[model samples]
Target: MPRPPTMEDVARAAGVSRSTVSRVFQNGGERVSADATVRIHEAAKRLGYVHNLVASGLALRRGRQLGLLIRDATNPAYGHLHAEMNRAVQGVDRQLISVTASRHDYGTAEVEGLNRLIGQRVAGVFVGTGVTAAEDLVETVTATPMMIVGRPNDHPQIESVSYDERTHGRLMADAIAAAGHRRIAVLTAPLLYSRVFDLRMRSLAERCGELGLTTIPVDLLPVEHGVARALDVAREEALSCIVCPVDFVALDLLRAAVARGVRIPEDVSTVGFDGLGDGLDLLGLATVRLPVAEVAREAVTRMEALLVATQEDAEGPPPPGGDQGGVDATARARHLVIPGRFLPGRTLSSAPEHLRT
Candidate 1:
């Protein structure tokens, strides 16, 4: 077999020293001249040289890897979040170690996953899963820096970049009202199941109350079975709409309606959060297109800033007024809520005259 190309080979081809090539790749190209950086990259591409990030971290014996704990990898929302976070981490030239957990359990698997990442000596962890409670996650990671991502979190001690579910819920409710849905059925789940979903339902119901609209609460336990019951309620009570906490649930309801020969938007309107699934327009499902990519990008950016601040604090105070990389780990926690826009599909429209009271 032929010997593989190495950074030394790349340096010789780019007319730079080996150390310069090392600094350019490992330090995110900071401090290196743009021309030199470009030459180094082009030369490496020509030679088919790939950086061995894992080996570099091993040689340094320091945490050069970031960890991500996400829930239900199969779920489209989390799946998209995982892809976006990977892109952001790669942009900074760091390796990402990801862990997945099912939502059915009581977060034991998630806690163990966190420990595994900590055991790998990761510098920081991004908790993007809605499966674990914020308090439990906070308690588990005492040594490693942890940040909440893509989930609702308000712990005074934890910082998070999450979707603005409250605003999303309100926006959805306004849309329903505008469509002449005076009475609706809201599918809900226990808070322990998913705080994100709970917040969505609560905000939608609250906003509906403010609008003087009637809301029928339907418990969605054991999702498949609950969705069937919710459909029944929508039909029996002559509800004008059924609001789902997530797109998957809304899809389930739409499928069930089809099985029962029920017409969507004509018999009863339907709406959901998280516009991630394909064929949404074909299915004519109304939903909110969540800012998954935006949240993922911001979360990784925050994680990078946090890592820099931690390093500075350990190396001694920065010279007075020195930049802390736009993040202060010692400061009180900060929460950022990014909003999503609504998709007015064929599923939600004016209720039938006989059903609209």
Candidate 2:
């Protein structure tokens, strides 16, 4: 039997993509360039291909969908939070769909995700930090309920559930300073800036300054090369301690220091934020533990409230398997703040008798 042509055939012939072909066919939606549209048709003719969305049409409908937007889905901190929410939504028999994007894709993905969610008529959306610009989401969630999880915004259209990041920074700085460290390095996550990042840095620096300790910021090299960079920073700066914004970065620095013949706490000490399980227990890392489970529970309760309120106007939810967004009228502008707990570990200690700098 002869094979029937598909969208992939047309896309390849037109020098475009399967999605571009889809955009052309779904003229009710995305606008493909006129040139590309013309080429799509020409290729369809040459290849004897007919675009059929029949399979997509026959997919099962998920009537009660919730949307979640987060970055670095592989990160354990966000992973635990996402898992709790997923379980809760399922317990109530609703499906949660999520969209995970990189920090670079934050702007376009949030807006696009929201548009897709609204079109799918999801009951509500739960947005994680770094997903998109907060104000954009404030305006986007008018028709559906939206709970901004792990992110904060001033706009009255949305509610935010957040950790008290200010306190988290102060705790780390206080612990390091109290240990009598004279000079320290803040190993930050690659090079991304956000409100949370800025807040943490400012608080820690301010506290360290108060203690007459010198606090310096250094861009953490990616994991593969991070240890070497960390060792260089430590020896060059004569640093008494290395403070990491996240535990994973802290671990990398520790491994690097040990390889360079530096003794943990005996010569130099280390501290990090986010005391995620297993890793922290194994490393005995002195860190600040975020209340992820609390944050997740709050987000679920708030978003579910909004979803129930929008049931009349909302349509069947987005089909599950991925992330989504929705509009909610019942959601009110509110901010929730939670504090972090500090964990002491063997890695922390007093400053070396004679600091280098």
Candidate 3:
């Protein structure tokens, strides 16, 4: 069997220094001319010199790898975002290491696992859900660089990227009120796994108050049992429309409503978030389409910047508290709110003439 070509072999073949070969492979050869890059590639190809990323990372002390921590990988909304994040990371020539933290069991075990990733020297981390203000984990994550997605809270050191669920909730309430539906009910899963859902509910409640509309809260069984519970709620409340937090829940609601002979949009309107799937297109459920791809791209970019900033701080004086400390007053001023757009679909419309004012 042939032995793998080494960096020294490539350097000898190209008549360049070993450092030059390393720089070329790492894409950091700013001083090396384009001709040098071409020669290095040719020599490496001829000699079968494959660059080992793990070895390179160890040498530079900066792993070109990212850690992605998520909860509820089964949730379509999260699944979509995860795929987008993976693609974006790969696009930038970085590798992703994914970890699933249990939704119901986020304890010291999870924190220890996350710390292990940091110890392994991941460039940065992107947390999808199930991670919150754990002091130890927060300290470790902030000490390095991290970004959180789909959660509202911000940390002194971590950057958070999520859609304005308040805006989405307000939109849902306004639409239902405009349709002359005064008595509406919102069906959602447990609050623990539904922080975004809770935010939307609060926003909707505020809007309902302003519009002089009435709202009923319906706690659906766990998401896994949503279809049956939502159906039961529709029957009991005679709800004119049901606002759901996700497309899957909305799909379940639609099914239950239909089973009970409830007319969609005509007798009862439905609205949900995270527009995903052509199947939903056929159902025509009104929804707020989250910018999943954009969110992933932005989260990864922010993570990269945070990692770079962390490294710079380690090498030099900590950036001014106001400027570099993610917790500083200046950083607070940098908080960003990206809004979501409401997509009007066939599932929502004016309430029946009798139901309207």
Candidate 4:
């Protein structure tokens, strides 16, 4: 077997200094004279010289790779966002390295993994979800560019891009109220898994106050196979409408309601958030379609800006609290509330005549 060609062999064959070869590969051939670049290419082709980016990045003290840290890829919400984020990263000409931390048991190991990406010198990071305790991660990646998605409250240093859960919640409340739903029950997961749901809760409460609607608070429902429990609660409370945090839950409710001979839109309307793909239509569910694509695009944009800032500050003073700036103020002062449109499917309608009267 023949030994692989090295940079020195290419340099010698091209009749150019090793430094010139390095510069040509490192900073694109356009940086070098066109004649010299042609010579290098010819030599490289003849000698089978492939650029070792790992070694090259080590020599330059920088890696051009970006990290995408997500909670669970299986979650439809994150899955959609991840695809969009992948496309956005490619569109911006950056490579992405993905890591998933278990939603069930996210611990310090996951944090260490994120830090490991930095040790490998990733250019930037996009945190999707499931990272509990971000204070350390935020500090470690202070000099690295990063963006956090779907979290409302901003970290001191990490930039966050998310849909306004509060606005979405308020909208749901208003829609139900407009349809004359007096007794509304909200079914969702525990607070830990329901940050957005919490916001929605607050907004719903506020909106209900304005509309003189009464909201019933029920125990948090398990996301996986909680439809039965939700259905039981709906029946017990005689809810006029049930606002679910996820489409799956709404779908389950529809099934449960059908089994119990409950007429949708006529007996009890249902609304769900996070408009996923098809099949929801077949169930005739009403939902607020989240702007997943747009949210992912904006998150990537924020990540790019943070990366640029990190690179620019590489030689400058220590990053302020090692946190990404701009995101905190913007997130707090004015949440990027992307409005969700109500998909008034066959599931929601005005309350029954008896209830209205």
What is the clash count for each candidate, in the order shown?
Answer: 0, 9, 2, 2
In model 3, how large is the Cα lDDT of residue 121? 49
> Model-by-model lDDT, in order?
0.81, 0.68, 0.68, 0.66
221-285 in candidate 3: lDDT tens per residue?
66546655655665576667778877878887777667778777776788888786557777788
Error of 4 at 212 (Å): 0.9
Residue range with the least summed lDDT across 10 consecutive positions in model 2: 53-62
The best candidate by TM-score is 1
Better of 2 and 4 by lDDT: 2
Please provide, for model 1 over 80-178, each residue's C-alpha lDDT reduced to its tens digit, 9 standing for 90 to 100: 999999998898889899988886776888977886665555778999888687777765754356899989988876789999999999999999998
- Residue-by-residue lDDT tens digits, candidate 4, 100-200: 77766545555645655554446667776744555655544423456677656556555677877777777788788888888777765555665666777
* TM-score against native, each model: 0.79, 0.70, 0.72, 0.72
By lDDT, the best candidate is 1
**Residue pairs clashing, model 4:** 157-323, 157-324
In TM-score terms, candidate 3 sits at: 0.72
Instruction: Give the higher-TM-score candidate: 1 or 2.
Output: 1
lDDT of 3 at 156: 55
lDDT of 4: 0.66
User: Model 2 Cα displacement at 230 (Å)?
Assistant: 3.7
